[model samples]
Target: MARPSTAHLGVDLDKAGKQVGFISIPHSPHEDAWGAVRIPICVIRNGSGPTVILQGGNHGDEYEGPIVLGELIRDLDPATISGRLVILPAINLPAVLAGRRTSPVDGLNLNRTFPGDPAGTITQQISAFVSDVIFPIGDMFVDLHSGGSSLNILPSAIIEPAPDPAHRRRNVEAVLAFGAPLTVVIDNLGEPRTSTACAVRAGLTTVGTEMAGAGTVSLDALKICRQGVRNVLAHAGVLLPAAAAPAAREPEAILKIPGQAGFVFATADGVFEPCHPLGTMVRSGQEAGRIHHLADPSRPPETLRYGADGMVYGHRQPGRVVLGNCCAVVASPYEGSLD
Candidate 1:
């Protein structure tokens, strides 16, 4: 019923040793009639075990996932692992190359085009290739992401709400195994058109991350991303425990974003001034920030207040904001049990 993808893979996924290749997606522009966008992928296999799919660069500006996954593709010895590792460091090659959130080829957000259309735009075609060609063979999916150029998010690992309790529990376990300083149990964040959603719907254990973001990469976030990938591999049995040095077991805070009220948004276009930094504890109705009206200096600055009580999970990065732009998001500690 679905059209076949116009993408070609140069690497054999079932191959024994580590093989590096590209997923060539056909393209035709005014400058060239027959051109292709080559997305780099690496396949590492040793023996029989669960296959783990690791990916990054869903957004052009987020650099942590691509950096850590790139290093893994180069340094990870296939012989030390029991299963396969299908790594796509820069899944959205066009966006990564352009350093923009959406692809320059089609001006579409790859994240929102899940289980995509082969007959659609370049972004949709890429999504279709990943959904059709990739998701079917994966046992677990790990997508790394940062806030990109928009927000500064606290370092956290996120697990989506699954179809069943058992599946949800598996995702929760994966988040724990990921061992990020902040673990978030999300209920889709009102956006279902994501790679994580695609993987989860296909019954794969999915774990995603929100490493620090703000256009520039953070060293602290990089450390978490690097170690988190290894932790997930070790947890999935794809990598031996000895091969991946685990982080010191510590009691990490598990949080959940309360729907709607947890977010603070700009009501009008203006320059924003935050009252608190991320990780700060605040109460509902508290002054979160203020937006100064530049067009009319006489108008008093609008004071934005929190709608929910929790830790400041994320906030807008740039000083300028437009109407409906998210200014801050609060997350409360999750007391519910996944078990």
Candidate 2:
């Protein structure tokens, strides 16, 4: 069968039975300091069926997603599958190679620049590529992400509002298949800047999976993601394997906290001694943690307290705690939800 052509954005689909490759969606040249960066994509199709795009490395520091996508490409046997699979392991090449959160030149987040501008900044150019070249070709989508530098997030999936019940159910079910202990279903709270949300708005069943952390790879997390991808394929009938036994369902809940309620740090520079562990539940007035004068143990420790009751979702890693830096994140139930 002949592949479809997209002339508007210089995209062409090259297919071999169930395997298809998208070639040469041009990106704006990187700044002089960063050298040139090109965006490349490949699509694999298995006979005739639904199309799915699996993307990773939206944030340059998230390693697990890109690694897992690499493994998927290597292990995938197109002749054995039923539909098409588009794999983009490095969506933000410059950011990925630079090991930074955003493009070094633009200093803008690629993830937040989705549905991009054709005549905008470098980040906007990449966003336009995804919006024009990628989103239109898929029936379902999975975007992979992780904690950027200096943060460790428990593996979870983010499911935004679905346009319909069927898509919503599939979104949740697909997330659960990833076997992450936590699954956060967010309304996105008007953050339309996200790729997944953009895809969802475009009427695609999209979900974002969060694995490992900051520029580091965890083999265990990779395994979980790998299995999760396969499970999603099986669920979608792209792969003919039986679904794996389900993992224990973690207590599912939404977190609510004031928009202003995040990690509160001390004004003076000092050594931080956290009084709480990750996932600790705290009340509004409870001391979440503290900072102390490194040289004077006698001096009073600066107390950090929450403005609301909730569980800690994340905390500052061992390092200098700067003023205005978030030291902890408290997750409460859905009444005052950000989602």
Candidate 3:
């Protein structure tokens, strides 16, 4: 049964046309009584076929997905597509506008609140609409992401293994089809409330990404992100003449993050100085970074070391670090050229 969501979609998904709409989020704040936060959404449908839901701006500071999606919404046409293309350039309107990772309004992390409560806060309502309304309609999903203000990461596509072997295999295939330089299968760190998890519960294949970060978008990141979208669409049968992409891209190198053993965290609060760059291989006991006590020059700097031999897949963006902050993340290599 489809519940009428508090978040309203402004367009008809069944109609064979292109339309721009908003997911109207009700907000009655002290400033205004009749105001609503409108999140951008677009639908392009030519005929009956698979539906692909593409979104970015889950975190306000991440630019790769939002940049690529905004361009897609403006340039994509209904006649060119065989099925339906749903685009949400900015999924979290409050956070996106505020340029923060979480919604400044309710201090909610949208990604962490999925299969949400319709009667909850603004972010929860949006999440509920996506899980209940959007997930039901779309056959495939891509929620793009980046490291945001706190981290810089190698361009990668991330997927969690489905419980079923066939579903797991197909999900891997989709990640390969996206053809990012690095493909990581997260073995742990389950985000049960994510849109991808919602899609999985509905038995749909999904692929999400972690592109360039540090809270800024680069031309190179956009180029790969746009191509990845095309590759996935062609792979999913939503776009015609798959040759529109390169005959073939170099196969992505598969990596795996095996639980908490895969990360290095800072124990002391200070300014962190990284010893390695993204994609660098590190040996166990090697110094990942050094935390300097800016306030106390006499105090010896604390050095963070790798506990396992692996590639440095992620790093904090800002040099400053705090106790318990993840300083670097490592991933075990699987196969293929990392070139």
Candidate 4:
């Protein structure tokens, strides 16, 4: 069994009104012996209903989520919603402050530190609190994410296909209701330590996003996230349904990433030259991009190819890349429904 978490909430989670406070995690670093890292948290409860946990800043560089969630926290009236909305706009405060993917304090990626250890590092402790405490109160989990500083991704709702048919259907419904430009069904992306994985293990209806990313927030992506979150909340019965917009439409496409094969990695360190933009369809073994050996003008550029036939879902944002870095990811059209 895991150790009990040392984290504590500053506000009452069970209260009947809007409460905003911090999740104070005890951190005794070199500078301070009794210091605590206070993560921003807000709980909005009307009457008794299901609880939805909304998280952002899982990866610090992703700004779209934090921006949208923050807006929701400030603008959303507690009276308009039932149940609760537990908001964590900047979950990884250290990373968000540094504007990096991983925590500056522990150098660990918060996303991969799920089901965390209470007796471990700061990042692990935060994860442990979420897994052991917060998840138990949540009927659904919505983790908002973008490509962060690494890649540019098409705006899409992402989910891992659950083993149980009924559970899988609910997830599908939530994703479709989110109504992003695309719906991506990826089986944990070959890493099961993510927030989505932890929430799934805890039996919460989990949904994530891969909105526009390239180290900067996009206005279009923000618009998509804002509306998508509201739609999901309404679908979960936490909030009353909003008036349908005149431009409302179903998701533009549904795609699936075939395990690890869907991702194309850099084989050597060099400047990447992408051959196609996001959403371009290509066949297996097609040239996805090349790594130019800028240092050695005489050396031939290392050509990279797609591992499968699919649309380009994402690619590295930075011009330079190292071996094993994900250069591109492809997702095939999902013909069958998760249901």
Question: Model 1: which ten-residue window has the lowest total lDDT?
Answer: 243-252
> lDDT winner among the candidates?
1
Clashes of each: 0, 9, 0, 0
- The alpha-carbon RMSD values of the candidates against the true structure, listed in the order shown, are 1.7, 4.5, 2.7, 1.9
What ranking emerges by TM-score with the best candidate at the front? 1, 4, 3, 2
Query: Which residue segments of model 4 deviate by more than 4 Å?
Result: 1-3, 243-252, 335-337
Clashing pairs in 2: 18-45, 18-46, 19-44, 19-45, 20-43, 20-44, 20-45, 21-43, 263-327
- The TM-score, computed over Cα atoms with residue i paired to residue i, of candidate 1 is 0.96
Q: If the candidates were sorted by their lDDT against the true structure, best first, what order would they fall in?
A: 1, 4, 3, 2
| Model 2 worst lDDT window (10 residues) | 1-10
Q: List candidate 2 segments past 4 Å from native.
A: 1-14, 17-36, 163-166, 187-189, 243-271, 292-300, 333-339
List, residue by residue over 79-152, the lDDT tens digit for candidate 3.
77889998999999899999999999899999888887888898988888888788888888898998899888
Model 1 global lDDT (CA atoms, 0 to 1) = 0.90
Tens digit of lDDT per residue, candidate 2, span 186-297?
Answer: 5545588889888987778777776757457877678778777777777667877664445455335534344455445555667666677767778887887777787887
CA shift at 174, candidate 3, in angstroms? 1.1
**Candidate 4 lDDT over residue span 219-294, tens digit each:** 9999989889988998888888863222243433668987677889999999999999998999899999999999
